[model samples]
Target chain A: MLAASGKLDRRELCRALLADRGDLLVVAGLGAPAWDITAVGDRAENFPLWGGMGGAAMIGLGLALAQPARRVLVITGDGEMLMGLGALATIAVQRPANLSIVVQDNEHYGETGMQETHTRHGVDLAGMAKAAGFPRTMLVTRPEEVPALRAAIHAGEGPLFAVAKVDPSTLPLVLPPREGAYLQARLREAVLGPAAHHQL
Target chain B: MDRQVMESRPAAADWPDGLYELLKTHRIRQVAVVPDAGHARLIRRCLADNGMRVVSLTTEEEGIALLQGAWLGGDKGVLLMQSSGVGNCVNMLSLAITHRTPMPMIVTMRGDFGEFNPAQVPMGSATQAVLEAMGALVRRADRPEDVVPTADATIRLAFNTFRPTATLIGQRVIGAKTFGKD
Candidate 1:
C-alpha cells in the first residue's frame, strides 16, 4: 500500500533504498548524500558530477531502460530537474518499468548556495511528475512522515516519484573527506557477503 | 576521396531523407549532440525531426556521458559536434575507454580544412591524433559527397563493433557559410 512520512525526506529515502537489494541507485546532479552511499559504500556510482545539472536524470532513465530487470532509482534535485525539464517527457514516453525518480525539492540548489528555483518559481513538481506519466506519486513536506513513504517506495510500481519538500538549512552536518573505507566495508558485507571482500 | 561519389551525394535539402535513412536503415534511435555551426544544418534538422530523440548537452564531455548512458540503456547513439570541442571531451573519453562505452561521434571539422580562424586550428589539428590516442576509429570526410555514406557507415560500425567512430567534415562539405545569405 502507498504511504507517506512526515519527519523524514529523500536523503534518508536514498539511504534506505541503498540498503535494499534489487535496485541500482544513481545519485545525479548534486547536494545529496548519494555518493556517501555509493562511493563510501563501494557501489557502482557512474556519471560523476563534473559540470552542469540535469544530465543524471537522463542517465538514470537510460540505465533503467537498459537493465530492465534491475530496479533503478534516480535521486535528483529540484534545480537540476528544472534545468532539463524535457527529460521528464522523454522518461514518461519511454516509461521503463524499472525506473523510479525521487526528487528532493528543497526549492533551491542546496549544494551550491540554496538559491531559489522553478519550484520556488511556482512550478508544481508532483503535477509535472504526473504529467510525465508517473501513475503513482507522493509529495511529503512534513517531518516524522518518512518511514511510511519508505514502505510506499518498497511496494511501488513503475515510474514512481516521491517529492520530498525539505528545509535544507536544517539538514544534519555531514562529515566529509568521507568515510569511504568504513562505508565500503559495511556495504560490501551487506551486498556481496563477507567473503567477497578480497575480490574488489 | 572519390570525386564521382562526392558529386552524386545529395545536399542539405536531402538531409531529412538522409536522416530518415540513417534512423531506419541504421536503427539509431538515440543521439547525443553538442551544438555547433559546422554540423548545425544536420543537427538542427535532426532536432526538429521526430525520427530520433536529440539529447542536447551543456558540454562535449556531457555528450559522451549521455552516449554512454544511452548505450547502457540499450540504444545505439551518436555524438555530434565541431572539431574544437573534441578537447573538452578527452577526459570523458577516458571514462568511455575504461568502461568500454563504445562511444561514436560525428565531428565536423572547423579549425583545419582551410580554416580562416586561428581559434579553430588547434583542435582541428589535434582532432585525429586525439581520437587515435583514445583508441577511437577516426574517418575524415573531406568532401560533401562522402558525408552521408560516411555518417551512415560510421554509425553502423560504431554500434556493431562497440567502438567510437568520428566523421570530420571539411567546411566545403557542410557549407562554408550559413544558410539564407552571404
Candidate 2:
C-alpha cells in the first residue's frame, strides 16, 4: 500500500542521489533502502553479505579519504550498523567532506528474515551519528522529506550523516545464487561510460 | 641515563618517515588493518598520518570486503594484519577469489621464527597454504632492509596483476620485543 501510494519516496530519493554525481556508491550488508535504485540505475555497486551493515560506510570513508574531491555514498542497514558501531568513531576522526552515509533504517535485517534491530526499539540513528561526530545528521521518516535531505547533503560538506526511515517493502533478495555480475557490469558502465577498464 | 644523552636518543625511521611516501608513490590511499604486534609500527604509521586512512576491522575477513569497496571506490589500498589472522579471513578470501578484486596486504607473521606460543604455530603453518588455495601470492621479509623493496615490488605486482599479494614480515625483522614490554 505504501509503495502504491508513492508515499515512501525512498526509491526517488535514492534515484536522485545516484543520478547526482559520479562518486563512489558502496552497498554494504543487506536490507538497504536503495535496492530499487541499484536495480534500475546503471550506477551504484554493492557488497554481498547478510552481515556487516556499517561495512559500506567504512569503505566509503576510505574512498573519501583516498580521493577527497570525489563524492561517496554508503547505503547501510540498521542491523548491520549495530555490528560495527566502532567504525563511526573512525569516520569522525577522518572527517572527509566528500563522504555521505545514508542509513536506510527499516528496524530489521530485512533480507535475513526480518530479524529485530535497534531501530525497532526507537533507536535514534541520527542522534547516534551526531554523537559520533557527524555534525550534519538528519532523520526523515517520510518520503516527501527526501528533497530537503538531498539538498542538505549536497550543500553540507561532510563527514555528514543522514537517516532515511523507510517502510519495509518486499524487494528482490540478491547475494549468492544470483550473481552480482549484472550490478557490477552496469555500475562499471555508469562510472566508465564506454571507456577502457583501468585499475584505480 | 644523562638528560642530554636521553634527549639525543639516536634517530629512528622518523616516525611516519618513508611510509607515506611509499603509500603515495604506489597510490595506496586506503588500508584495512587487523591489529598484530609485528606490523603494528606500519599499521600505526598508516593510522597516525593524515595522508592515508586505515579501516580497522574485528576480523581480517572484513578487510577483503573493505578492499572490494576501496577498489570500486577508486582507491588502490592494502590490508595490514598478522599471519594467524588469515584463518579468520578464509570466506572473505573466497569472495575476493570469486570477484577477482586485486588486494595487497602486508601480513606481519608471528609464531614461526622463534616459536614461543604454541597457539601461533597452527595458523602460521596454515597461512601460506590458505593463501595459495585462495590464489593469493605470498612473499616474506626477514630483515628491515627487505621491508621497503619487498613492499614496493609486492604493491607493483598487486596493481599490475590485479590480484592479491601478501608481504609476510617475520618476527625476525619487525623485532620480538615490539609486541610486549616488561
Candidate 3:
C-alpha cells in the first residue's frame, strides 16, 4: 500500500505501470507524459508525440483496432485528455478490447507553466470515461493502487481508462527522438516487422 | 437525420462504388468518419465490408490522428467528413504535415451550388484554400465520373509521395440538401 498522501510520485508510478511491458505499444501524449515514457527508456515500440496535443488516446485506438492481437497503452495528461474528451465516447463505441488509456492527472498544464486545469477543480476523468461506457475505469491516488492499475492495463480486456493523481512538481525533461518521421518509421518497423520497409 | 435527403437524391451514380473498390484495391482497411449525408453510401459500404473497420468519430480531427496511427500500425485508412468538419481538423492536420504521414481524406462539400444552410458557406468556400495552406493537396470531384480518378490521384499523392491529400466531393455530385420539406 502506498502512503495516504493522495498524490503518487509520477516517475515511480510510470515505471511501475510500464514495468516488464512486452509487445505493448505505447502512445505518450505531449509534455510531461512524453517525458515520463522516454524516461522509462525509449524503444521502437514507444511512439511519443512531440506535438499533436489531445491525440494520444485516439492514436492508441487506431493502433489497437489495427493490431487487435497486441495491447496498446496511451499515457497522457489530464489537460491533453480534456482537449479530446470526445474520444472517450468514440472509443467506447468501438470498444477495442486491447486499448488502455492512462491519464497522468497532475491537474495542471505542465507544458504551459503549470496553470491549473479543470481536473484541479474537480473534473473527474475516470467518471467521464465510465459514463462514456469504458469497460474498466480507475482513479489512482496511491502507490499501492498502481499494481492493480498495471494489472488492468496488461489484462487486455479493455477499453480501460485510468487517472493517476500525481504530485505536480516539475521534473527534469527526458526527450525522445525529435523527428516525427523517424519515430513513425521505427514504430512501424517494430509493429509490422520487415513488411514496413516494403511500404511505399 | 439526413436520410431523407439521401433518399430523395437523383439515381445513384457508379462513382461511390468505384471509389469503394479503389479504396479496397489499395488495401485501405480502416475508415474514420463524422457522418454526413453525402457519404451515406460509402459509409454503408464500409460498414458492410468484413475486411474493414469503420469507426465513427465525434469530430473530424480525431480522424487525422486515427489515420496516422493506422499507418503506423501497418494499415491504411481514409477520413470521411463534410466541409464544415474541415474547420475542426486544421491544427490536427499538422500531425500529418509535420510527420509527413500519408492521409487520404474524402470531404463532402456543402454551402456551395444550391446550399440551403447559410452557416456552412464560409467554411465550405474556404475549404480548398485552407487545405492548401496546410500543405495538403486538394482535388475536386464535381461530376460523378471524376470521383474515382480524383480519389485515385489522392491515393497516389498521399501514399506514394507521403503527402496529405483531400478529395472534395462537390454538392453537384452528391446533391445539395433540400429544405422546406418537413
Candidate 4:
C-alpha cells in the first residue's frame, strides 16, 4: 500500500514523545496513532481512541482546557487530521497553552487498505495548521528533529502543532482496549483517583 | 391562534435562566456551543458565570467529543446546539455512546411548528429519530414549565447512568422566527 514509506519510524517517534512521561495526558487518534502510542506502553494517561475518527485534536483541546496546568498531547494520523481539519482552526482559536498536536503524516491511510490521503497529493497539513494560527508549527522528516518535537510536547508553550512524516508501512496493532467504557473509566480513575465514579 | 397575536407578543421565557441554574447545580465545568439564537439566552448566562469554561465550537460534533475529554479529566459538561446541528454529531456520538460518556445536550428545535426555512425541515424533524438511532436517549420539552424538569431528567440519565441524553426543546418554547420585519 504505501507508494513509498516516509523516513521516520512512527513507533520510535512515539517512544521519544512519551519517554519519561510525567503527568502528561495523551490522546491518540484511531488506527495507527492509537496503536503507536499503545506500542510504547498502554498506560492510563494515554486515551487511545478505538473508533472516534476525527476527534483526536478536540479531545486534546477539552483535556487541555479542563486541566489547564497539565500538558496535553494528541497523536493522530494524516487521514484523521484531514477529516477534522476544522479542529486545527478551533484549537488555534482556543490557543490553550498546555495543548500540543502531533500528526503522524504517512501520506496514506495506513489502515483501510493503505489508501493515499490528501497529503500524498501535496496537501500541507502543517501549513494549514500554521495558517490556522498555531503558535508553533513544525514539519519533521529527519530523525534529529524528533528530540525537539519531544521536548516541545513536554515543555513547549502551546497550542502547538507538529506534523511528522512517518513510515507508511503497516505495523502490528497494539490496541489498548476495545470496550470504550473500560478505557474511559481507566483514564478517569487514573487522572482523578479511585473515587472518580462516585463523584456524581 | 390569531395572526396578530403570533406576530405581536414576545413570549415569557424563563427556561434559559432555569436551565443555567441546573447546569451550575450539576457543576458542569465545560460548556460548548455552536451558537444559535435559540440558545442565545442560555449562552449569555453561561458566559456571564465565572464558574464554567464556555468553549465556542466550530461544529456541534466538537462538543460531543469535547464532553468525553472533559469527563475523562474529571469534569462534567454539556453541549448546546440547534436541531440542524444534530446531523453533524451522528458519527461523533458513536464514541460518546460506546464510552458511556455522560453527555447532556440541550438542542433547540428548528424545523417543526412555525418553521420558516426549507433547509432546516429535513434534519429538524428527524432530530429525535437520529439521536435515538445513535443510542442517545431523546426527550422533548415543549412547554415553558416542562423545559427545566425535562432537562433535569436528561442530565440525570446522562451523568448518573452514563448515557448520552438530549433535551430537545421545541420551537414553541424557543419561539418561532419569521422572514418579515416585526
Off by more than 4 A, model 4: A1-6, B1-12
TM-scores of all predicted structures: 0.59, 0.75, 0.94, 0.94
Scored by DockQ, the top model is: 4
DockQ of each: 0.19, 0.27, 0.66, 0.67
Q: Could you tell me which 10 consecutive residues in candidate 2 chain B have the lowest summed lDDT?
A: B8-17
Docking class of 4: medium
lDDT (10s digit) by residue, model 3, range A10-111: 878889988999999999999988899999899999999987788889999889988999999999999999999999999999999999999999889988
Q: What level of docking quality does candidate 3 show? A: medium
Candidate topping lDDT: 3
Per-residue alpha-carbon lDDT of candidate 2 for residues A130-152, written as tens digits (9 for 90 to 100): 89788688887776677777765
> Where is model 1 chain A poorest over a 10-residue stretch in terms of lDDT?
A175-184
Q: Rank candidates, DockQ, best first.
A: 4, 3, 2, 1
Q: Which ranges of candidate 1 are over 4 A from the true structure?
A: A1-10, A36-40, A45-52, A142-156, A170-200, B1-65, B72-76, B80-102, B107-140, B148-166, B174-182
How displaced is residue B161 in candidate 1, in Å?
12
Stretch of 10 with least lDDT, candidate 3 chain A? A1-10
Residue B43 shift from truth in candidate 2, angstroms = 5.0
